[model samples]
Target chain A: MDVRTRNNVVVTGREDGPALLLAHGFGCDQNLWRLVTPILAERFRVVLFDYVGSGRSDLTAWRPQRYSRLDGYAEDVLEICRALDLRDVVFVGHSVSAMVGVLATIAEPDRFAKLVLVTPSPRYVDDGDYRGGFSQADIDELLESLESNYLGWSAAMAPVIMGNPDRPELGRELQNAFCRTDPAIARVFARTTFLADNRADLPKVPVPTLAIECAQDVIAPPEVGRYVCDQIPGCRLVTLDATGHCPQLSAPEATAEAIAGFVES
Target chain B: MSGLEQDAEDLYENAPCGYVSTLPDGTIIRINGTLLTWLGYTRDDLVGRRRFADLLTVGGRIYHETHYAPLLAMQGSISGIALELRAADGAKLPVLVSSTVKDTKVIRTVVFDARDRRTYEQELLRARRQAERLAGTLQQTLLPPSLADVPGLRIASHYHPASTDQVGGDFYDLFPLADDRWAFFLGDVSGKGAAAAVVTSLTRYTMRASAVHNPDPVAVLRDLNAVLNREYAGADRRFATVLTGLLVPDGDGFAVTMATGGHPPALLISADGSAEYQHIPGGQLVGPLRDAHFASIDLRLRPGDTLLLYTDGLTEARTAHGRYNEQALREYVLTRELTTAPALVEELTRLLAGFGEGLDDDTALLALSVPPA
Candidate 1:
């Protein structure tokens, strides 16, 4: 398989510098790193790409059996590193991609030099003796909401009077294009993400790691981040004052500064 | 404050859908009466007391924080998001919400009461699931209950459905004919669901009826082809690929005469630890054509020799290594020291299970072998 086309890989920055691979999370694509990529690009060869089922990657490569588990995504990461001949690379992952990076790094520790995780959660559902925050019922409702949302989007194809009329085109674009994921792929991805249990895989990281937890994050709470830090050996935990799940988007400067400090040190 | 015909109070208080304005963190700031009434809440109960996420069920809250909130933060607006709200009295209220961030601070949400819509969708889902169950049950009645055990042969068969929701076209049966002779056939129809099921039931009964009159494998298929062509040779014409065989006890084994109608070649494993495909070349698809010809091959099944007939679903199943084509199947069987029919069928069942999601089609396997006496 052509790794570049399959993953929609975009490589920039100086060729002589070390490589920084950025993996996006569930909702958006590689564009999630739009704010942080420029800052990192000045010092490193920035690599940004989308998972096969998301963004502009080749959707035909999505096979349910292959992508049923997180290992398939890890294989993509390893394959990307192999294709670019990237050695001792710094891997930066957001949301569920953090766990994806953990799996990849564990599989081949020599390839990744440093790890940066943004709002990462090893498990979403609360198990015994662990507060992963959400429950199994909540994940099921999330799936139901996705189905209902997909139904609304598809059923309202013939332009209805829903949102503001002043910026009708913006409303239309939101209904038609923005954050548009294939309903089937999105459902499977949601199940794979929210239902996954990677707590056991967290302690296996062999490289220096950084866990950035956002304040008041409803998805990955601060406690989950601390748990990740405590499990992994010699890992540093940084809690951002930025609210919401995405610190990279809400407060890119601080997020980039935190990442820059880790990479430089 | 404006004296215009469409005043701010008129729009906010009596909009078609429920409107709620909240802080960036989903804390309720100002809400409309329509939303308050739908949730059985007073103004003081929600306005400053609760965030928007707090009103949702455990699941909806997670979806709101993870998917909805993130999208609103990134894109500044999200439309037509379906979520369930927990009412004041613990009832579930399904709502379609559209929210937008104003100046990257306040969040203005428009919620549509989707109780009726949700009910209709649920009904549709229920009806679809019911239809799938009915189709599945009907599909089961088309095949034989059990393969009758012949004195000289050890036989076993398996049917694997890629999906339990819809009925597939693959089928197999092994039954007694007359005078200590046994008849067995495995075939796959062209389509799926109820229509294909009708064709399958007809083909099975017709093969049995035709075989009783004329026990020749080729003649039996010819008769079935004639019946199917006469019945369904119209616009919605259905066809089938069948491999029918008649097994008659010879000495310590059986002589098998099998005919193929565009079906996959059967595998013959010899007692000498070798396997080869019994390819029948000039066979045409049964039904859809008036004169579909079939050819029969005669093979002597010696002691410790096994013969396996199957549908194309086995050979055409997609695998990580590529399609499990005839050559791959031949290589797999050639490598295995297959002695009994049951063992070979069990191994093939495991191989099919290994395909997982790649095996999108239904498969039917029927094996007949002479045990080493």
Candidate 2:
């Protein structure tokens, strides 16, 4: 498979400079990195891609069983690396992809140099004394809401999501085009994102990592951020003065600066 | 000012839809009186004290941050997002909200009450689920749970349902006849749902009754065609395609006599590993015409030979290579070198599954073979 087309891989920025793989998380596509790319592009080569079932990525390549777990997403990241033959790469991941990056680096340690986890969470639902912020019931309620949202908005075309990528011209006419996702595939991604328990895998990360948490994010709270930073050896922490789960969109310049600073340092 | 028109302040405060303006960080800087009344909150209680997301339920908050907020940021505006907000008494208020950025990305959001829409959608979903369940049960009743085990022959059959909400029009059955001969028929009705099922059930019983009386392949099809044409001759003319046959026991094999009425050609796999389709010429459809010519063909299924009958769903499947038509199926049968009836049925069943989203219709398969001597 041509991983570029499969993952909708887009490469930009200084070509000769070091490569930075920016992986967007659940809910949005690689367009989430639009604001940050211009800043990061000045010094580093920026690479953006949508996960297989998200955005312009080939939806036909998506298989439920393979993508139900985080391992499947990690394979997509690793495959893109091999396809581009990228080495000593700086892997930047957001939301659930932060854990995906950890898994990817652990699989191919020699290929990646550093890791930057944005609004990262190793787990969303709490277990034992762990303060993952939300409970199992909360996650269940979220899933139910997600289901209803699909029915309300995209239910008409939900049945035809397979093998049908929205035309580029059609995306131009729709206001919510960038976040256009197949409802069923998005549900699987949400299940994989919100219910995943990657706390055990954090310490397994090999390279120096930067845990960029938001000072006020309900999805990935300060506790989860500190937990991830504390777990991984040589992992540092940076809490942005931001709200919500996506700092790149909320505070684009600040986000870009942090990414560039970390990569250069 | 005229008595017919209201001032801007009155219009903004008492509009049908709720409007709230927020700062870049979602602080509720301005809210209309209509929304304030709906949520049972006063201006002092909400403005500058809460963010737009704070008024939402926890799940809605997650959705807002994950989907709604990012979309608004990327697109400069987002509309018709379904979310629930918590009222003062903790009752959930379902609403559809549209937001756009203006003046340094301060969010301007409009919320519409969606109680009736949500209720209607839930009812529609419930009705859909009930219809799917009914279709599933009805389809099960149409098919025989187990084929009758005939002596000296291996018989395997499989039914692949293309949808859960609507029953397929295709059906098949195998049963006994006089003199210990077995009679079997496969047919595809041209309609769907209960109407098609009625025609399908009628065709199956008529074929069986006709064969029991005459036991001739051509006669059975002719009777079915006449019965359907007579019963549904008006505006709702229902038609069907069938391949009905009788299996007469021969020396170490079965002499299969079959007739086709516009149905797809059935493939015959010989004992020597060769495969070919049975083409009975001049066979028209089973219904609609005043008089249709039905043709019959005879085949001797020797030991280790198999005969496969399937609906057009198999041939019409869209695959990676191309449309999986009859030629592809025949090539698949020959090249795969499948030896027995059960094995071929199982492999074809797997093939149907491999078609995945490409298989667009309900399919039925029936394979019969004489045990290897």
Candidate 3:
């Protein structure tokens, strides 16, 4: 296998163990997976990387139009799999990255063995026939708030995004971290993460899948998580008593345990 | 503290409005004669007998404790907030309140009659509601009663207004042209509200009329552009991005001939789950020039293929950190394997709804799918 040293893709672990690839979601870089890495490091060849346009990745590789779609993200995933030349790999993706894993697996089913999707949502809109917990009007209000005051909206939306507005400091921390992102890239990424609906692609995923549902998560509620599992063939749904969007941040031990169980099984 | 003897003190006791003083915890420490009279209570009935919150209406009390009191404590003073007092007759008296925290940990709350300002605000709200209703009704009329039904196709369209009280410039129409052709256009006029509504109405009417006379998509846009340029070119300098397409039924499918005036490309999702955006280059803004150039693109819609027409609202929608551009649309459409038009439009609408709050402009979506024979 020809290995390409693209930015943000870090491969480190005992080469003798099973291969596991860890991916983070939007508004965060690879550091988010840090808490869970050491726990898994003992048994698996843990591969970690930032998605393009995030963290210490090659900023010059960022293309506004190309990165605007999640498929480009899936492309990077496949590239990482090719570069690492790993077989029977367990792919773990958080938040929107979970959907990215689905797309990537669909693109190259032979490259991956199993997928562990954390808080995955195929659709976020409510229709007459379907419910994703939000209405078009609600999205409009959120967009307007974002445009009217980007910084203030980020600060206010942080707690909501973090799933606890009462913890003002958490909201502040999220805002500060989110503000570190390039405004233009962040805006495009925001659109891509929220706007694209991959409900139709769920059925096409051929690999064994595990949908890790967060019990108290407002971002990916129980109903939506169950719906996602129902759509994917031969997929198991496990609900963890995690509160926020980032379970690795709120309940790292439970999250790690779940992954460990899934991988062992 | 003899106040020019007791005679002069009597004048202050009889003054209008209410006054009360309380400790930091809201325990009543003092009450004046005027406030006592208004509540039909004597000095003994109020002073040290009840908290200042007791005289307020239920909502007023809640507001005072939750917002007013806390704000006052944090800021040392709060003023000019409206509140309601429970009067002697069990009626509510509207009043403006100002509160200050003193060094003694006592809070002095001064109340003033706000009947005039209250009345003015009520009238203002009523007028605003009336204006909003008018705009809503007018905007409703600007849209087609229903999109014209075409044979061999399943269609569904949705229009999201930006503001309830004001109409936006985005508009879409699906109508039949003479001789078995259907012309549909989705466009966004510059600016928003009433002025944009006028342009939207005119564009919709003009497109229909122009299509009746010339059955070609490019010709219809050209003629509409001339009219809009003539009408709105001078002081307003209004323009719009429009995509007009003519659908003609072919063998088990329809041939879509579309012309673009700086509009986003239409998405075509084939039966096998492959999707691509119809590239129409050199499409300039309509109504900006006397002779604005427009580009037309042609595509053969096969059985189980879906064509989606939309305004820039979809592409420009904000995501987590970026705009929902053509690339995302391509990725989404490519993965879905949409077999019908309703499926295509349904997914598009779902995508738009997901972008929620990030989609600032008014969005209009129209989808046409050729059924499998």
Candidate 4:
């Protein structure tokens, strides 16, 4: 399989500048980084991609045996990096993507220069003292009859999904998904992300890392951010004055600036 | 429209549906009486105090932040999203929501009660599953538990249902007639589900009863055609492509005499594995027509020779370029050198699996061979 086509890899910005590969979290695709991409692209070579089961990436390539684990998603990240031959890269991951980035960086430490984890949680369900912010029941509720049915994903999103103005060919592309999400795939991804235990993998990070948290995030609270920073050696923490799990969407400018500051430093 | 326009404020505040307006970031900015009454929340409690997402249940909140919010920003509108909200008393209220971006900073939304609809949908889903289960059970009862053990011939059969949820139209059976003669038949009904299952049941039984009455292949098919025509001769008449045959041990091999009613011909593989289709020219469809012509072919299955009978589902399955025609199946059988009955059926079953989604129709295959004795 063509790795670039399988992941829907989109490369933009200065070719000579350092590479910054952005990976999105669950419940979305590569479109999650659209708001912040333009800002980060000015000085860095940016890469954006959708996970196999999410967004416009080929749904045919997704299998429950492969994508039912975070390791499967981590493989997607590593494959994209290898496909582009990207080296000394700045990796930015949002929500669950942060854990995915951590696994990828651990697998191929030489490919990455810096790791920027945006509103990430190594584990979502609460364990004893380590609060992942959600109960086991809450994750179950999200998985049960997951709400986003791509066939029923509303006619309003058609224009954006059919032929996005920014890239008209995306509509013509196979499995064209801008914002629409398949519920079956979403359920698997949700299970993989929420039930994962990547806290053990955090301490093994081999690069400069930044854990950016939101001031008031229900998904990943400030303490979880602090815990992430304290776990990884020499990792920095920054909390943007933003709410919601997705800072890239809720607070794009601050999210972009924080990422740029870390990447350029 | 004019009357409603005259009382626009009253209608907006007290319409059958709840209407609210929120900021681009989902902060509740405006609310109406009906919605406040539904949630038992005052303007002071919701507006400027909580965002639209904050009012939703935990799962709904996650769905909103991840999917609803991003799509709304990208598309400027969203519709008919099912979610639940916590009423002031903490009871969950199921609702269908549609929101449109009224301006750069404002998103107007309408929320409709979906309590009854959700219950109905769940009931429908449960009932559908039950029906499918019953159909599967009924389908199994229509086929023989195992192909009857003919003393001199080796036999294997495979059945594939396109979907597990609904009963398919394809069926096959093999049994013995009196006087050391064995009877076998394979056929496909036009439609699927419980209705086609009825036809399948009738066809299987009718073929059995007809063959017992007269083991002659053409006579048996003619009797079936007459029974089907007499029973289902209405405007929306049903039809079936049936193949019935009798096997007789002929000293060193089995003499196979089979008749077809608008069905694909059986493929005969010689001992050396040269495969070709048996031509049954001008076999008319069963049912509808008062009198339908049946075609018969007589062949001998010598040592190491096999005969394969299948429904159109096999020949009509789609390939990347077009339908998988009979010629392809012949070439596949010849190249693979499939001469044994069990080997032919098993390999063909594997081929059917390769069709995947393209195999939309049910398929039935029955292979019989005279092994070296």
Per-prediction DockQ scores? 0.19, 0.33, 0.02, 0.26
What tier of docking accuracy does candidate 3 attain?
incorrect
Q: Candidate 3 DockQ score? A: 0.02
Per-residue lDDT of candidate 2, residues B289-329 (tens digit): 97999999998999989999999999999988888999989
| Candidate 1 C-alpha error for residue A99, in Å | 3.3
Q: What is the lDDT of residue A184 in candidate 2?
A: 81
lDDT digits (tens) for residues A1-265 of candidate 2: 5999989999999999999999999887898999999889888889999998888887767889989999999999999999999999999999999999999999999999999999999889999989998999989988887776632335332212121234433433352347667778888998899899999998899998998988888788999999999999998899899888999999898888888888889
CAPRI quality of model 2: acceptable
lDDT of 3 by residue, B148-218 (tens): 98988898888877666888888888988778888888989999988888888888899989999987888
Per-prediction TM-score: 0.71, 0.81, 0.52, 0.74
Among these predicted structures, which one has the highest lDDT?
2
**Top-TM-score structure, candidate number:** 2
Chain B TM-scores of the candidates: 0.76, 0.78, 0.78, 0.71
- Cα lDDT of model 4 by residue, A1-265, tens digit: 6989988899999999999999989877888888999998898999999999777787767778899998898899988888899999999999999998899899999999999999988988889998888898987776663643321233323433343536545533522545545556677787788789999999999999999998877778788999899999999999998777788877899999999999888
Most DockQ-accurate candidate: 2
What pairs collide in candidate 4?
Answer: none
Across A8-42, the per-residue lDDT of candidate 1 in tens digits comes to 99999877778899998887678778888888888
Docking class of 4: acceptable
* Model 3 misplacement above 4 A: A1-265, B1-19, B22-27, B32-40, B59-81, B96-112, B232-236, B302-304, B317-324, B328-360, B370-373
Model 4 sits at a Cα RMSD from the real structure of 6.5
The model with the greater lDDT, 2 or 3, is 2
Ranked by lDDT, the better of candidates 3 and 4 is 4
